[model samples]
Target chain A: MLNIVQRFMKRLVRQFFKKKKKVKIGLYGPPNGGKTTLANRICEDWLGEEMGSVSAIEHETREIKIKEEISVKSGKKELKFNLVDTPGIATKIDYEDFVKKGMSEKKAKQRAKEATKGVIDAIKWLDEMDVVIVVLDGTKDPYSQVNITIVGNLAARDIPVLIVCNKMDLKKAKKKKIEAAFPQYDVVPISAKTGKNIDKFYEALFVIAG
Target chain B: MSLTLQFVPYGEIENLDSTAKVNKLIKIVKEEKIILLEGRIEKNEETLLIKKTMEEIGPKFKGIELFVMYPKDEESDPIQRLKKSVVDMLLGNRQGLTIIGPATIVKEIRKDPDKIQLLTKNLSKRKKTPASRSKSTKKKTKTKKRK
Candidate 1:
């Protein structure tokens, strides 16, 4: 009788865990490199609503922002992804915007200091990620601060890093340059603004994200 | 077998002391096959991080988001809702997901950036965050305490 109860409990627990399903993705890139644009593109298909802010200002994102519960469906399989967008990565930070909000210059400076933490935060995500979308700017070459660090770091973690070369609509986009630099990984040249190569991007994500 | 994990830095982290947020995150992240948290967070944000780290790695990898946050605003208080704004920019229906700071802020983000450096080192070196460190490894020291 005890064995029967144990078996029943085991079955119950198994069912509970097996029924659960989902996926999470972290968006990363340099300042003004269009990280949020990619995230918005992903979620737009899910909720048909634009998520996150896109702007020309550098370091627009200060802290780590996570969007919980994004439902992504690939045919019969479904995934719940929590999209987290990042702040820009530069060598220095400006506290003026923060200070304008009534914070003391000292606190503003301190807050400005904290804003720079995004770079390290970007690295830490590798251990915690299953799939890394290294959003790239097609208008520019692939070798730069954020690109080098992002690709190099993702490769080190052995995490599947998908190179999304964004802004392909621009005439200056040179996909070959980035593809040549990181030939080891899969590079998908795309335009986040127009949703070009989005389908291909998702197909790749579905396989690697698994 | 080693659980392969991947990560990407995207957004920022804030809202200390919100267990509900963490719990909700845990629920969502626990569903993945593996979980990884990348990038740098402030000293004050560590506790909140552990809370979510527990969430993202609940069961463990194969299907998880490489969530990353780039910080922009940095006020000590919730005055401008920088956290919210950051989220808004990253995932909450905004135009661009970026942080606005000066040159000092850029170079400064990399200083003594052990956590940040740990991440970069782990990625570039292909080692674990603490495992890579021969140093007694920084304990789960509280990030920056609320001023």
Candidate 2:
């Protein structure tokens, strides 16, 4: 009787899991482009929990933060999405800021070099992701080095990419030039800070995920 | 003794006082004849020089600790293996890094000044003068002409 009960329990757990499709997405952009803000928003909305820290400091996230095994309800079936958040990709650092802020020159230089490695390592994550949600800071110029490099690398690989033009809540956001600069991309302008247009963003992702 | 020369990336040179200070405190390795020579580069192109040094020595040195002193990036984990290597190299008691005598190291570093300069400029640490790449390309032309 105990053996039958154990077998029944095993079957129950297996049945509960059911059939689910995993959608692996890599979220990337230049450092400070609000990649984490978006990732946190997604997890919080879908999973009702804060997954990571959202900071304003440049390269605040020095490591590739992964929020995996996220369960989202898609119609009648259950879906799983693995989201990987990576460091920003700013190739240049304003050394003057480091000095004025009382940051040691050595530490600043070391940090700048670090930002580069973090970016490169993050980009490498693209090869493993099913889709790459490349974040963009609309407040900054669209023709920045990190943006160009990220888009260029994505195009070369032919990976499915979606440009998340975040920070729309800021008055200085310029969406047109960003679209003009990269005419060939599917760009979605959303404010990760204010949660504007997030539902639409999720809807687009669901279609793509399907 | 083997000589070891350090060419820190230009982006990294701004903290010369810190990098150099930290570097000086490290114990020098003597087994692989390690001599650590260092210079603060201001040009980005000089990075190519540093990467070249790693590529050249990386093969013979087997593991990076044997020769690379500042090869690890700052973003690496404080407890990871690579960071430990950097600390080991900086502290001068190279667990795996071989120390060449300074005299021997200087000779090795000076052997290819022109080649080194070319690779250094490729690093883009210095100002991107339009002529940087052309300058090296000119040398290639001369070599081709001689051939």
Candidate 3:
């Protein structure tokens, strides 16, 4: 009877938190910064599936991808939220560049138009984000305009943010640069490609989302 | 490392529509050169430029880097306010320029207190020079090429 009562109390607490409004978590970053890769990692770990495809090509995620009801557990604490993987934010997109990548002119132009729409949509979607994870390539300079924009937008919206300095598996990955770039927020260095130091990411997410 | 800097000049804002201006900007950026844009584009125009620019980028071009500077204003329209916040988010770390390209130079557009700055660092000497100005003479060349 004691064990049964304990299980009953746990269920009651779970249901109570579950009844609260769902939190929306957005993954935003520049092209090839591992936003989708990190989303895939989170989804694979919790939801047992992939979020979207990743590519070396720029703007591979030309659309906003979403997964709902992702419950991440760290210790006894459980945090549930929706994961939104936005298109890579960029200042410019050119089809001629795509043409050089071996794509036909027509297809490249089509991609350009879609990617433009995707960026606008991603910015618009910012209103809906409850919490955001600004992912960055740890090997690259964290002070780029794209990185600044992601953080600025989040701050403007008064949304809580966690900076994920991704690609730590690379020999050149520097987590300090990212931390130095935004000293106000928490920065987690992880490799979404190789799943390195992901547990810390989960712990960070729990604190931000909880 | 020894580097050759290419400077792409901006045109009159009154002359070109957002799309035309962005298209021209993309063309210049495609040459793997840094291009500077000033008060010619507004908040919406910048958004449109980003949209159009991303659409044209391919595997060869890799990506384009943007740096912007705006006066710190306490009073702005809702949209302007949002753009400022967006700009802050996009251009978060402001120190010196950062390089993230080689295949195509369309990299680094910076704005300053009084003037706009661009640094187009071409990594591969594969492409021929396309009527670009040297880093030292960027100011003079920009004045000479102005519309």
Write down the RMSD of all candidates, one decimal each. 20.4, 19.0, 12.9
Individual DockQ of the candidates? 0.03, 0.03, 0.23
TM-scores for all candidates: the values are 0.49, 0.51, 0.63
C-alpha lDDT (0 to 100) for residue B56 of candidate 2: 28
Query: Can you give the lDDT of residue B17 in candidate 1?
Result: 43
Residue A45, model 2: Cα distance from true site in angstroms: 0.9
Q: How far does residue B93 in candidate 3 sit from its true spot (Å)?
A: 17
Q: Write the per-residue lDDT of candidate 3 for residues A1-210, one digit (tens) a residue.
A: 674787577556545654576878899888889999999999999999999998877778889998998998877888888999999887667777687888899998888778767887888797777789999999988877667767876774457899999999999999998997798899999999999999999989888778
Report the C-alpha lDDT of model 2 over B62-131, residue by residue, as the tens digit.
1112122223234556578766666755643222122222221222221121222111112234333466
Docking class of 2: incorrect
How would you encode candidate 2's per-residue C-alpha lDDT over A1-210 as one tens digit per residue?
A: 674787577546533443343557888876678898999898988878776786655876766888888876657755577888887754334443455667788776565555546655665576666678988889887764346556766664555678888898988987886897687886888998789989778766766554
CAPRI classification of candidate 3 = incorrect
Among incorrect, acceptable, medium and high, the docking class of model 1 is incorrect
Best DockQ goes to which candidate?
Answer: 3
In model 2 chain A, which range of ten residues has the least summed lDDT?
A: A13-22
Q: lDDT scores for all predictions?
A: 0.55, 0.57, 0.73
For candidate 1, what is the TM-score? 0.49
Specify the poorest-scoring 10-residue window by lDDT in model 1 chain B: B57-66
- Tell me chain A's TM-score in each of the predictions: 0.75, 0.79, 0.88
